[model samples]
Target: MLSDMTATTLDVPAELPFLQSLSWFDAHWRELTPYQMLQRYERGWRHRGVTADLSHEEAAFLRGLIQRFGSAIDVPA
Candidate 1:
């Protein structure tokens, strides 16, 4: 009977855009080092005013990076 048949998985494309945006760490974020991530976060905040594109999880991740790396270090002028 069709109802009793086991379900088969569908062949889905891996690079779906909607799925990528929903993930916690997309490919670009995954490739960045902690310091580079922090710099990107700060730049976003500066450019976007109070409406930076970062989610709370991203902010928390940057907080962790700041704690680990120490914010006193200077960026090159």
Candidate 2:
């Protein structure tokens, strides 16, 4: 389980497009700073939780997204 360290109840839309929902997650946690929220997204998706239920293609794309850019996220601008 990706440690649900924060006691948050995100209102993510189950039927929303993958990218859109990700953007939403990003926007929602803006206070945490982009880097911080991105880390949370990566962590949240790492274990079997909400993101675990994503479709295979979606999950692959997410993994690809993380691999391509998330691996070395720069400080939030």
Top TM-score model: 1
Off by over 4 Å in 2: 1-40, 50-52, 72-77
Q: Mind sharing the TM-score for model 1?
A: 0.41
Model 2: ten consecutive residues of lowest lDDT: 1-10
What lDDT does model 1 reach? 0.42
Q: lDDT of all predictions, in order shown?
A: 0.42, 0.43
> Candidate 1: which pairs clash?
none
Q: Compose the digit string of candidate 2's lDDT tens values, residues 20-62.
A: 3445546554355333444655655434334334555545544
Worst 10 residues of 1 by lDDT: 3-12
lDDT of 1 at 11: 26
Model 2, global lDDT: 0.43
